[model samples]
Target chain A: MNAVIVENIIKTYGKKKEVTALNDISFDVSQGELFGIIGPDGAGKTSLFRILTTLLLADSGKAMVDGYDVVKDYKAIRKRVGYMPGRFSLYPDLSVEENLNFFATIFNTSIKENYDLIKHIYVQIEPFKDRKAGKLSGGMKQKLALSCALIHRPSVLFLDEPTTGVDAVSRKEFWEMLKTLKEQGITILVSTPYMDEAGLCDRVALIQNGKILSINTPRGIVDSFSKPLWAVKSSRMLPLLKELLQEDFVEDAYPFGEFHHVVMKDQSDEPLLRQFIEDHNNDSAVLQAARPDIEDCFIALMKN
Target chain B: MRTLKFILRKEFRQIFRDPGILRVILIMPAIQLLILPWAADYEIKNIKLAVVDHDHSEYSRQLINKVTSSGYFILTHYSSSYEQALEEIEKDDADLVLQIPDHFEKDLVRENEARLFMALNAINGTKANLGGAYLRTIIQDYNRQVRTEWIQFPRFSSETQIEITSSNWFNPLMNYKYFMVPGILVILLTMVGSNLAAINIVKEKEIGTIEQINVTPIKKFHFVLGKLLPFWILGLVVLTIGLTIARLAYGIIPAGSFLTIYVFAAVYLLAVLGLGLLISTYSVNQQQAMLLSFFLMMIFILLGGLYTSIDSMPEWAKWITRFNPVSYFIEVMRMVVLKGSSLADIKYHLLKMAGFAVVFNGWAIFSYHKRS
Candidate 1:
């Protein structure tokens, strides 16, 4: 059986239907699978997580976590599932040790009972156990939060943007931690706006405007891009983009850190695109053909 | 039950760790108890008086001296004209104008009765009424004195006179502090209980930690109980300190048993704390919770008969006070402390408070949404 199932969840807000936060959302995450819901801000990621965690009621639909219905079996679901919200939701005035011990006690367990699950993360923060949780650095807080969530030995863990504000190195280490947790046969459903983090998941669902755009493996998503894409650069990057969009074969062009990612009509060749950019700009201009990535696929899906 | 224990433990740890809230809970009530009763005293003294002694007789002069010596009035004006005395009252310089008619003693000796006119500034009706009543008692005493010395009839001496001697029960000296101390203590307990309880849950919401607890398996009733128990215990502690200060500073001990006060307080705390939790559940943040609690508290205290008598209130206001939990507690405190009334005397009050506890907590638990 799947660890999490969300079937046709719909949610709206405002008295006049001013916002539709979620629209006909449906997905399933298998047991022990690492599922990623990738979207930008206002893409209804938090709303979906709240619905599945039983914090909010969906306007219409059904969801089940740990084989228990989100509504009817909320008490049973609450015991077996662990949820870390998008924000750091622990007591700030409490010490790190106190926070962890309090959460463990409330779950009717002790720290010694699940020390193996959190030993690696707790070791990094154990030295500052006396300091208040609010005084700790961002990376330490993230690790401490993860330790608290996993201390209960839950069968399914839900992390909502766990690494949104951490440093790059900490983000990498956090994803590594998630991978280890996944290996221990705990199904994980994590959401983030960062496209690079999608590569760390086994499968990802691209969501935008409260609707699911596509759900596939990161490699599969990039491989499915059916346009001739290339990276174009010139001495004046702004002018190159302006001149490229005026071309008849240019489908879309966007700046992707030092180079501009250019997508042309299917029949257009890379050689013709390179020649077009070189003739319109200075001699310092350069063009190179490159493989598409997850970001490219997201942008393509959003455009379609 | 185990979940409730853990939650209560967490609440206690958080409360004790923050030194600011700790001082507010433990020490502030003591200071307020010592200071507030002295300020809230309703005993009217040093009322400004203006007298128009038209007769200028020995009787009028004697009456003026008697009024000033009563210790309740300060002779601010001694005008010979009633118009001038009225001016003093109109200027807000005097609270009362005493008028002695011409030939006041001659008319009394000849006709056996005379009239005296007194004008009072009734804007502050309580002070005015009390001052007028004091003046009337003093004049009556003077009348009885004059009639005894001036009238020398052998037949009157043999006739009988009805002498009435009255004793003030509970408070023989009529000390205002005794009346005010217990009432103020009730307010202090309610303020601390409701403010702390109302802000407790909303602070968790503001910090985003409520979602973590809400998604857990802990029952909603357990959560509400956990939030209320800590403040309930703290309120009892505050009450103990307040009672100590009342005894040490104001010399007030409950005439009744401590058991009576505790029984009433425990029930009162449940009602008050439940009200506070209900406010927190509806508010979105700590500031909103504080403001909402403050608003409700103002209404509750004013209508609770702390500073005013419920019997003296208007028909509509008295109806509102019937539903106010603070009013019942105040009545219980007065009955047990001042009147030294036993449990049987306050049985009706205890039942009302118990009813309030059940209804307020039931509404709080019902309104608290565990799912959405």
Candidate 2:
């Protein structure tokens, strides 16, 4: 049931032992599934999408999109897959409608033929169809680009960090649009740097340094972490994190937004954690055990 | 074929929508046609002349009068001695020096022939050659005038009369505008289309939309061709307007078929659009694309024979120009408009342009790798 199968893909740059963008990376996306490749900027997510889209040639690997090899059957694969890049790649000078139509025409299809599938999204920007794509708002451009990518009614969709620059509401709407596309039996493989949105994907792959650290359902990945996490906050929170790192019992300490998420090295017991805190001249300092999320699990995996 | 049409349509729409680019394509040619004639004349008008009259005689003064009276030479300095004239020539203040030897009036009547020296600056070889030839002819005519009685012919003997008419080819009067307008039209199209298309495509790369295109189902060729097509059509429209101005406004008529002109224009436009595509493919930003295209266009226009004849360029330069398709098309346009040449007459130039189209398009597609 895997819609996409990337096996041992390696892509390197420069002449003299330059950067290896994707180093023997391997993954699979199931049919009718929403797969997220979660990573920060320059973690080989874009490089993977390009290879799957057949826009790039891999150094040493085999990738199959919808049962077609990305290299040998690229011509066949191009017809069945839609790729939406991280940036707003639609023609800015062309009107919204013109941009959509031009892309549709490239695939030898028309907007009218696939209007129903894109109606929900395209209708939002229908009033500004005559306006140049460059003049459209960020959210409006995202919608138009998605509609154009889906116009050909591809079996699989590759969106390489599609919502990276979008607003919170737009990002929400964009994920909803992907859900709608998913309902149409399209396999959606989207990459993003947003950890919060990682929960929204049916399954997520946490990648870093050109390698996937772990791949599992977002909840399963979080639940599988064995560490005891504690949210520590004080009037002097940053100084507390620096002090906690020096402690023998504390395994890892990283700031997760407002408070620092801490884990102890000894799992058998809390290991005199309360005494270390009480010894400090602290008042109204809150320390409590908290539920770990996907990011916590990713941090644990990256440590190993 | 359908994708090509779509891409072409999109390109045209993009160019037409951007008013700045539209103006660049059309307005530049109109201005060049109207304004260029003033400054781009082959007939030298502003010639700087230095005269050294050793005799300081009336006859020597009359010879100076003849040189200035021709309306070509500009007399700026009157040198008292040959060394002073030599200094004037060496200092770059004078383009040509007129040296009359000592006792020029005594020598002319005494020796039956007196020599006059003209030192021409040959840096700009064309101007120097033409100016030198004109000066020599004018002084020779003055010499004949002085010895009119001595050089008399057999008087009024009834000679056998034969009437012959010589047909002048191309342009009988050799109107410079006729030669200029067609070539200028080609260069204008190239300047605007190549510059605009290149900038537009590279702008997308700079802004991050090129990644979007790469991820899309759109083929690379379609992506590039669609972008190139709009400028191609805009170039054609500008070229048509240029030809109309040539015929109606400037009174330089085309001696060949309009269809032939447009047909050739279609191929030539593709070649130029390919050049633009090639330029954009190498540039990651609009600034670099503009600079590269501008540099390439300068070479194209200069080698195109817009200001001077490519035929008259040096042997090495002429060899280099043979590879420039603009030179061929402009040459063909002139030959067709002036001489009324048929298809066979311009076979070489047409074939050359066709080759350029293939090579340029090939380069355009080949340069579409991951680098830029």
Candidate 3:
């Protein structure tokens, strides 16, 4: 069963409706599936989350959460869904335990009622339950926020950029928590700007500029890249990137970490590319056929 | 109802946790109440007099002695030149000038009438007017005494005097603090109630917590009530502190029962807190809410008749005071504190306050959208 369905949702902001935040967007998530929306800053990920969660209204389309219409049955949707906004939305002055207890009581439940669901995440921050939320480190605050969002045992949870500023270790731990929550049959829809996190999700929708570029499993997206990709690195990285982009056979080149990923127009032009790079400078250079990742697929999709 | 309980708990916990809000709620009222009443005294005294006596006769000296000894005027200059006295006025040294003409005391005995001229530096209108009135009363008393001395026998006198004795009611001593303390108490209550409530919701918005609250299933009425009830109770707490200070520091126990003030305050807080919530709903951030509250408060307090009489205001200004919630509370405070008015005596004001409470809270609830 589809836990969430969005059909051509359009939302615009400003007095004259000049800034189109979401434009003809549509997607769906099945029950118990961990879905992801992968994009960079200002890519309309937050706008889509707000619309689906019923915190915002779409200019011209329809959305449903847990079989309830986001517009007409907002009250029903609100009772069944959990939303944690992109920014830190918990009260800073409240202690961690107090914040959790407050959210739980307001939802007409108690912490002990759902302690088994959040025990793993809650135990990590349990020692600092008395400390104010504002004084907690970035990763700890995110964990506490997730706990508050889950205390009510919501069937569908929406997390917008939950791991944006968290450290590498905490991000991994947060994904692990989501995996456990999914096992208990809670459908989760999380948005993040990190391309590497896309592989962790069951499926991802690549979005940019208020539009979705591609929607599929991370491996499916990578397998769909139809061109030969190469990773070229030399002693001088900046000049190597500039030299590769100047060649007509090199379709696209962008600096990815330590190597410049080069998309070639022809699969048989590798020898010509390697000889041209070796002749450009006296420094030793290495070139290899590299496999496409989600970021490479995203870059390739964005160019089209 | 249970949602409201949890929300109230969170709000109160946040309020008590922040020392800044605690100081504003508790210590601010105490300090403002203690200092404002004594400084806002309206009884004008110490008018400086520059005397240019062209006629230094016994009658003139006697008049100067009488005027100076009245405890209202201080004789700052006693030169015989009128120009020097004018210089004194220009230098801000004297507020009034008394120019006695060349009377010589012969004109009073032979001509039976004498003329005297007075000049006042009317820059401070209240002080100049009161000073002129005081000098005229003293000269008239001297004239009556001189006429009585000339009358040799009481039987032949044809003068008929009607003596009028008047007494001040309610406050016989005409104490300024008695009039000022109640008004100041109302202002302090308003500052604590309205500003804090206005900033509270916007603080949630500024820090992004309001969006989380908005996604919850809690009813709008319950949410607004949860936001309002804590501040409403805190407002009453502030009023109690103000009243205690008025009693202990100023010795101003209300002439009427405390129940009347509390009843009126309970209704008054609803109106003001409703106004604060309305402002928060319209503001996007804490700075905007603070600025809007400050602007409205300045207008309300100035026109609320705290320092000026609403009856004496222009017709247009009087219309504005009718809509001002602060004005109604100030009137009720003064009525119950000074006039010893009962609850029945202020039923009209209570009804007006109840009307404000309905209009403001209703408008606030209507405009506050759960999804926008």
Candidate 4:
């Protein structure tokens, strides 16, 4: 059964509807599935999370969480779902233990009751249980927030951009925690702007401008890029990108890290492109046949 | 009930952890209560008098001596011309001028009547009015003295006299602190109660913790009560400190029972804290909440009849006092502290304050939405 379902959700902000925060958005998440909503900043990912968490009302639509209607059975849904806002919303003045204990008691449960669920994450920060949450480093704060969100043993969890400001190593550890939580049969819905994190999710919905562009497994999204792609790097990268975009057979080219990823319009051979680049550049250019990643598929789908 | 307890625990922990809040709650009241009453004294003194003694007579000299000795006036300038006295007034040296005409004591002996002219700067209406009244009283007494000296044999004289005696009730000494301390106590409690409660919720909103609380299954009533009761208790704590200061520092033992004041204060706090919560719900951040509460508090305190009597206010302003909860609490404070009024006497104020509590809390709860 589906753990969450959203249908035709439309939300607009401002008196004159000047900003469309969520525009007719729709998606669903199955039980125990690790779902990712990948988008850049201001793509209405937080708005969607707020709607599902019952902290906001959509302009018009229907959503259900754990078989309870979001509007009609909000109380029941609130009891079973956990939400971690995009910002660190825990009380900064509260110590780590006090913050966790407070959330646990308010949910009508004790910390020991759900000790097994958050033990791995809690043990790391246990030494600083008396330290105020505000003074903790960014990664420690994220861990505490996750622990607080999970203290009640929620059936479905919604984390909005949990890794946005966290460091690289902490971001990897946070995702691994999510993997363990999923192993315990908890369905998690996490949103991040990091394209690489998309591959770690069971399935992802690539959203932009409040509209979902594509929802598929990361491998499925990369496999759907039905064009030959090549990565070309030269000493002069900017000029090489401009020259590659000017090619008649080249469908698209964007500067991706050190190399320019060029999408061919047809099934063209790699050496032909290599020879063409060597003709333009006096001699120092390396070209290789490359496979598309989620970012590449995202750019391809966005362009279409 | 359990949720409320946990919320209260968290709130108290936060309140105690922040030294800024602790200082505002505990030390601010002690300092304000100790210092405000002395500065807010209503008895005016040191009225600078520029005397234009044109008469130069025995009676005039006697009158000048009497006025100068009264403790209210200071002889700033002794001038022979009214113009000099006027110059003194223009320079802001003298507050009032007494110009005795050229009588020479002849009109008092032959005509039995004399006139003296007095001119006051009148820039400060209260000081000018009181100074003029004091001078007139002194002159009246001197006139009676001269009449009695002329009529040496009072038993044979046919002149009739009326005597009046008055006594100040409740406060025999007419102590200004007794009148001011109770009112100031009420003001301090109002300020602390409303401002703390106002900032507490908005602080949560500012730091984004309120959104996390809203998504929980906790009822709105429980959440608001959790936010309110801690500040409500703090409000009462401030009142206790203020009352102790009033007794120990100012020697003002309330004429009424302490129970009456506590009963009234309990209801008054509900109304004030409700107002704070209402302001918080309407505001989006701590700064906005603080600014709005400060604006409302200024209006409430100024019109509250603590500094100014409501009876003397303009008709429109009097209407505002009727709606001001601060006015009701101040009146109740004075009634209990000065008049020794009991709970039975202040039932009307108690009922009105309860009504304010209902309206404010109801509106606050209605406007505060779990989902927006």
Candidate 5:
């Protein structure tokens, strides 16, 4: 059975003429699989996590987490699932060990029983176990938060932007911790706005504007982008994107860091595009061909 | 139950560990209970006076002697001029003044009428009233003494009078400390309980840590109760300390049973913690939580009748006091401490508190939102 199954989940805020946060949102998480929800800020990732975790209610849909209804079996579901919110939400006054023990005690478990499960992550900061959780550095906080989430040996783990505002080392360590968690047969659903992190997941859903645009394996989604994409950059690169989008053959254009990742429509020959560009006297800029990543898929989906 | 215990342990750790939190909770009540009562007295004792003795007779000197030796009024200065007495009054040092006109004794012996003009400052109304009554009683006694020594016919010592004796109920001595310390416990419990619990949750909201609990398998009620139980227990601990001090320092042991007061404190503390939860649901930050908690404590104490009896208030204000949970506890504390009121006698207070518990806990749960 799937570890989590959500069907046509809809959550709206306010009563009359409410704000529709999640509309007809549906997905499923495979058992022990690492799934990702990729979107920019305000893409309903946190809302979805809250609903599945039973801390929130969806307006007009159903969700079953770990063979229990999200609404009806919330208590049993709570026992088996672990959730880390988009922000670090541990007690600041309590030390690292106290936070862990508090959470474990809340779930009707003890730290000794699940020590093996979180030993890898917990031991790194064991020396500072007595330090207040609030005083810990961002990286240590990330680890401690994850350890608390994992202390119950939960069957399903939900991490909402766990690596949000940390250094590269912490983010990398967090992802590695997720991999270790998945190895122990725990289903993981991690939501992140960082497109690069999408590659680390077994499968990812590219979401924007509170709707899922694509859901597939990383390689599968990247290979499915049938457009010939190119990076166009030159001396006057700032205006190069504006000029390119006004062209008849150019389908979509957006700035991608130092380059504008562009897609062409209805053009078969690559040299013909060069000729068109030459004819248009786009001489102040240089255009080079490139392959599309998840960001390209995201931009294309957003445009469509 | 174990979860509640664990939460309480964690709360005690936070409160004892953080000096700021501990000081905010305990220091205000300590000063109010220990220091303020000693400094504040509704029974006015010392009064600076200006006496204008126009008679200059033996009676005037005798009257001045009686006033000075009474210990209630200190003869600041003897002003020969009324203008000088008026200046002294304007200077604000004298609270009272006595004026005796020329031949004050001759007017009394010939016309069978005598008058002693007394002027008093009324800005400090309660003290002023008390001083006024005391001065009147002293003058009346002096007149009775005059009737005995000067009039020899109707001896003042033989008089028919009624003295309504007041037998103070449980606290026979009417020690202000006994009256105040128990009420102070109620106030301290609320400040500690509500502020601690509200700050705990609000701190999580502030630092973004509550989201961790939000995401866990912990039920919403469990999470809220888990948060509340600790502060509730902490409040009881503070009550225990304050009660111990009341016993040790003031020798004010509860006329009622310790276990009964403890049980009352525990249940009352739950209602208080529920209030904190309700406040937490409304507040977004720790500063707002602290501020709102402070406001509620002020409202509770003022309406709780800890300092002044509420029974004398109008029927409308008295009815409003019914909704105040602290009012009930403070009454119950007083009843138990002074009246030695048993659980059976205080059944109404217990029922009222239980109602408050339900109402406050219900409001807490209702206001506590699972989502925005």
Candidate 6:
């Protein structure tokens, strides 16, 4: 059975129906697979996590986790699955060990029983075992939270934006820890707004405005981007962007850090685009063809 | 039960680890009990007086001596004119102006009647009324004394006299502290119990920690129980400290069984904690919880008959007190402590408290949703 099976979930907020937080959303995660729901902020990712974890009710639809219905068998589902919310939700006043032991004991288990599962992560922060969770650094807190969520050895783990605010190195280490957990045959469903992290997942569903734009393997989504994309940079990046968007052949131009990612209507129009920017800028601009990444695919899908 | 144990353990750990909360839980009630009773004393004393005597007769001098020696009033101004006495009152120097009129003794001796005019500053009506009543009683006693001494013949036959002898039962000294300490103890315990429990869940919500606990397999009843039990234990500790202070500091001991007091307190705490937990469940944040709890506590303390007797309350207020858990507990505390009321004597209150406990806690558990 699929670790998670959600069909046509719809959720809305407010008495006047001013916000449709989740709209006809559906997807499934395979057992022991690392699936990702990638989207920008307010993409209804947290809402979906809340619904699947049995912490919320979908306005209309059904969800099953670990072969149990979310509404009817919430108790059974609760025992089988672990959920780390988008924010660090552990007690700030309690020490790291206390938080872990509390979560473990509430699930009718002990830290010793789950020692083999969380030991790898727990050992890293064990030196500061008595330190309060609030005092821990962001990366340490993330690990401690993940350990608490996994204390019961849940069959499936749901991490909502686990790497949102961590430093780059810690973010990389966190993903490595997820890979380790996935290797141990725990189905993991993680959500993040970071587009680069999407490539790390086995399969991803791009969501926006409470709707899923596409669901595919990372490579599959990247391969489906048929537009000719290029990165263009100039001495005057701001003016170059304004000039690129005004051109007829330039399909889209958005500032992407050091370079502006420009998509052309035709691959043959790249030389013309470069010449046009050089003429407009008066001198000193560079343009080169760039392979489309997941971000490019996401922007293309959003545009379509 | 195991889940409850873990939850309670975590709650206690959090409570004790924070030294500020620990002090509030343990020490604040003791200080309040020790100090609040003295401030809330209702026995009116020290009526500042300005005596205006227009009559210069020997009887007037005697009456002035009588009023000055009464100990209840201080002769702030022994003025010869009513205007002078009124000036002292306007200056806020005198609470009452006792004007003994001319022929104060001649009319009393010839016609067996005399008149005294009292102009009181009644800004604080209770103080003014009590001071007025005290002066009236003293004057009547002085009048009787004068009649017996001045009249050689008997004013009336002894058989016609009705001597009413009365005793103040329960508190023979009419000590206001004795009356107030038990009531104040109830207020302290209620504040500690309700406010602490009111903030428990809401603090978790504010810190974002409640979401982690909600996804666990813990039952709703267990969650509410866990939230209540730690504060319940702390409240009982507060009650014990308050009672100890009441005994050592204020020299008060329950005339009835301490067991009876504990039995009542145990049940009363459930209702209080339940009400608090219910507030926490309804409030979206800690500030809201604090404000709502303060509002309820204000209503509960005022209507609980701590300062005002329920017998003196209007019929509708008395009806509301029937539903007030604080009223039942305060009444029970006073009955057992001062009146030495036995368990069977207070069975009605105990049963009502048991009913409150069941209803409030049941409603609290039912209203709390883990999936919301």
Which candidate number has the best TM-score? 6
Residue runs of model 1 more than 4 Å from their true location after superposition: A15-18, A267-279, B52-59, B78-91, B99-117, B143-149, B153-165
The order by descending DockQ is 6, 4, 3, 1, 5, 2
Off by over 4 Å in 2: A108-113, A268-271, B1-5, B79-93, B111-129, B149-174, B192-232, B280-285, B306-314, B362-372
The runs of at least 3 residues in candidate 6 whose Cα sits more than 4 Å from the true structure, single-residue gaps closed, are: B109-112, B155-163
Model 1 Cα lDDT, one tens digit per residue, A10-65 = 99988886799999999999999999999999999999999888989899999999
Worst lDDT 10-window in candidate 6 chain B? B153-162
Query: Per-prediction count of colliding residue pairs?
Result: 0, 3, 0, 0, 6, 0
Candidate 3 C-alpha lDDT tens digits along B68-178:
998989999999999999999999999999988886487887888888889989999988887899889888888888887875647745667765778978788899888
Decide which is better by TM-score, 1 or 3.
Answer: 3
lDDT of 5 by residue, B1-372 (tens): 676677667766876788886676566655656675566544577888889888998878888888888898888869767778877878887777788888988886777668998878776776667777888888888887886676666555476767567898676776677777777778777777777788777876788766666655555676787777667766776777777777776778778877678777788888888888888888899999989999888878888898777988889878878888888888888878777778888777777777778888899898776554
- Regions of candidate 5 where Cα sits further than 4 Å from its true position: A15-17, A110-112, A266-284, B1-12, B20-32, B47-65, B74-103, B118-120, B155-175, B193-210, B214-237, B251-267, B281-285, B328-372
Minimal lDDT window, size 10, model 1 chain B: B152-161
Give lDDT: candidate 3, residue A129: 98
* C-alpha positional error of residue A102 in candidate 3 after TM-score superposition, expressed in Å: 0.6
Per-residue lDDT of candidate 1, residues B1-372 (tens digit):
887888888899999988977899777888788788777777889899999888988888888898899999999998789889988989999999999999998888888888999899999999899999999999999988878888876865687878899998988898888888888889888977788888888998999999998888788888888999999998999899989888999889899999989888988898898888888878999899989999988999899988889999999999999999998888889888988888888889888888888888889889988778
Whichever of 4 and 5 has more lDDT, that candidate is 4
Which segments of candidate 4 are over 4 A away from where they belong?
Answer: A269-276, B103-112, B150-164
- The DockQ-based CAPRI class assigned to model 3 is high
Q: For residues B12-76, write the lDDT of model 4, one tens digit per residue.
A: 98898889988987888788888888898878799999999887888888888988898999999
Off by over 4 Å in 3: B102-115, B138-165
Error of 1 at A128 (Å): 1.0
- Deviation in angstroms for A74 in model 1? 1.7
- Best candidate, DockQ: 6
Q: DockQ of every model listed?
A: 0.76, 0.47, 0.82, 0.83, 0.50, 0.86
